[model samples]
Target: MTAAARLLDDVCHLTAQSLNRLETSEHFRVVKMLGEGSYGKVVLAVHNQSASASVCPGSPMALKFFPRATTSLCSFLREYNLSLRFCTHPSLSRALGIAYLTPSHYVFAQQAGLFGDLYDFIVPEAGVEEDRCQRVVSQLSGALSHLHSLGFVHRDVKPENVFLCDAACRWVKLGDFGMAKARGTKVPEVWYRSPYCTPEAETARGDGDGAGERSEPEEKKRGPRVWASVEPSVDSWALGVLTYAMLTGAHPWPQTSSDCGAYLKYLHWFRTAKSPEEELDLWAEPQHQGPDGTPADFGAKEQPSVAPQFARFTPLGRAFFRLLLNPGPADRGRPEDALGYLGGAWVPVGERERLEERRKKSRGGGGGGAVNEVKLKDGRGLR
Candidate 1:
């Protein structure tokens, strides 16, 4: 038997004594692998127990298995605690149960996203319809806001981590809490962050904001505490990027890194909007016009207002997105602020059908799940 087959076979024969020191339930029939990540793999499963006490009978679930040898139990516990802590929120994927099968792996079950993730649903050069985008952004806004309120920040927020509960995206949830950390904790290494989602850390030179390795003077500085702490605002920045990406099927900038010219250009534009030397202009926002010739104002601040990448959104949407993507951590208002822009269209309604058609085509483009199709001795693929 292959090493993979033997490991799973060992798991299949789990008994009550096989349950390590963790809250666990009955055995499960592994159907097929759903996906895998750096830490472990997730498989689709259903309860195999005949006992009347089964919480779910035939319903499918996503079972995440972390091999003990490759993953630390403390990491597993952290993710589980955080996931269960936020499970009550409607916009978060619920944790079904958890188990530590003696020798093979530590496993946990979560409600599955059968339709796939938003990454699969999004198309390049053209994004989801405005109505659908509105629904998704609103849900994520709520989810992020809830997380922040609980003093945590979801360090990763991108299309791939956002799961679709349905094809039309009427219901979506923020999943994959492995990178999540409490506010005020030391931020993870830059290499661990999701590109374009997390803000680029200030360089050692202290180029932009001036509080790093070389301050006003290295001597005057008490110490070179360069790395930043985790802030709840990161989720808002990521949400804004995700919003614009989903609307235009492209990123506003490649990423917020100093190395990228696109990001540098965007950074300059963002700074210009906040420049005190520049004169303020009160321009009428698009789609906010009343019956009269005058525009109805919703009190949005003045921004550069002419980003080619964000042209897909209306002036109103751009204004809100600017607020969300603001580089200044203290100023990047709450994700709940997106609620105010929820009533209006994010993108033009005329392009809805075209966007939907693109989404449909992308969904049908089949590249199967990330399963390693290894089979057992019986030739039944390890079920």
Candidate 2:
């Protein structure tokens, strides 16, 4: 049997409630793997005891299991504690309890996002409909604001890390706290560093592309070696990127940090003063052209003189992007600023209703949304 199988066999029958009492961790009747990542795997589990079950209401809880070999005790504790500290907020997944079945297995239960993560909803290239995107921005922005107020920053904030609570995206939660760090603490550069969204690069520390070393026992090579202060601005920048991505299928820039042309173009679009070298670089970059020699990608028809990237979003969307992706770390606005745009036409009501129609067909469906007939795998839900 595999390590996971051993773990399941060991704890599937226990009714314990806390970490020290693994032998009594409830009798988990069913366990189905939901997703897996480098850190560990998340499984949807249901204990026989309903009232004592993790309060997911009508659904089973998600138990993310980490093996001792992969997740260090220190790392696990930090993530667990931080998650619980912010559990009071509706957008942050609550850590119900923890258990240590063996040196090889450690597990923690939390509210499950049965509808699946936000990445599933994003339509590649075209992006999500406006109202859907707006809903996500609203919930996640609030979550980030709450975390920042606590002086902690979720260094990694991308769509893949966000879980949806409903089909129309009216409710969502930002998951994966493993990369979250307290501001001012020098942490391994675990954030996505691409031209599309280089919040840390815009800051002084990561600007030079200095990689930091990981002090872990092994596999410390996941991110760049350069360590820098984890600030709230990093999350803000990520929100900007997420917003842009959800609004427009394409990223603002490519992934490489060495692309001078991409960075120059972005800077120009942002209206930041470029240095002499940057100006020269922007000048040297040639315009994209088609076989007929006309401009390959024209800017928005409404604003012919603007950058093509600006064509991706509406005027309101652009303003929201700018607010979250200010030039400097401290210059960025709070995530709550997104709440202001919630009433705007991120997507028209007519189209948003149509989008809602399609979401009803989703297999995973969602909670309390247009997806009225929530058909979960375990056949558990409200009629």
lDDT of 1 by residue, 8-69 (tens): 23443443334455433447777887777666888888866523332457778888888888
Give lDDT: candidate 2, residue 303: 43
Cα lDDT, model 1, residue 6: 38
* TM-scores vs. true structure, each candidate: 0.73, 0.70
Give one digit per residue, the lDDT tens place, for model 2 in 1-383.
23322332344334233455353245564457788766778888875554444453445778777777876665676666567545567888777754455556677777788888766666544466776787788888888888777677787777667787888887788988877766677754432345334545533333333334335642344333555676778787778877776765446655424445655565566674333234224235565643433335533233443345654443455567667766667777778866775666543344345444554444244422211122222221111
lDDT of each: 0.63, 0.60
The residue-level lDDT of candidate 2 at 364 comes to 42
Residue-pair clashes, model 2: 11
Residue pairs in clash, model 1? none
Q: Relative to the unseen true structure, what is the C-alpha lDDT of residue 218 in candidate 1, on a scale of 0 to 100?
A: 55
Candidate 2, superposed: residue stretches over 4 Å from native? 1-18, 21-26, 50-59, 188-199, 202-226, 256-260, 272-305, 346-383
After superposition, which runs of candidate 1 have C-alpha atoms over 4 Å from their true positions?
Answer: 1-26, 50-54, 188-197, 204-225, 274-305, 349-383
* Model 1 TM-score (2 dp): 0.73
Candidate with maximal TM-score: 1
C-alpha RMSD values across all candidates: 11.1, 11.9
